[model samples]
Target: MRPEIIRLLNENQEFRLFVRQNPQWYRKLSRDPSALQSLEKEANYFYGRTFPQRVERMQSNLGLAMMMMEMLKMGQDTVAQTQETFSS
Candidate 1:
């Protein structure tokens, strides 16, 4: 397989599935310039659809991490306050 096609399969799960499902198309893509161009465009489309969902999940994870940090800080502050009050 061409390095480009290998990379495409590695990066895009949908493309991997499509290639597996359409072996004849994969052969065509390898031999025909026009078919390769069309496959590349389809791969780009699939990745474009997936990229936004990946970004949204990352954002959600970041927000959850920030919330956890804030809660941890609050817990630390409460512990310090209780220690100071008891010592006094």
Candidate 2:
């Protein structure tokens, strides 16, 4: 491994973890230091560490939450309607 790459592994915990999780990157990077860029990009996407990935994840979660809220509101409305009918 190159000194720069070694230093990166030592200094950046996320990079180290990514490299550890994806051992194939280690060999690729050792063969071509320039492959570091691609490794980082793949790692970021894999781990949901990038801004766009994070945004997409948040959007999906938000949609799920909104759906749950709508379901809950519908349930409450149904209960209220049922109570009104029973009272009448």
Give the candidate number with the greatest TM-score: 2
lDDT of 1 by residue, 1-88 (tens): 5777778678877777877876776777677635766776666665565577678879999999999999999999999999999999
TM-score per candidate, chains pooled: 0.47, 0.76
Q: What's the lDDT for all of these models?
A: 0.77, 0.91
Residue pairs in clash, model 1: none
In model 2, pairs of residues that clash are none
| Residue 74, model 2: Cα distance from true site in angstroms | 1.1
Model 2 CA RMSD to the hidden true structure, in angstroms: 2.1
- Which parts of model 2 are misplaced by more than 4 Å? 50-52
In model 1, the Cα lDDT at residue 10 comes to: 80
Q: What is the lDDT of residue 65 in candidate 2?
A: 100
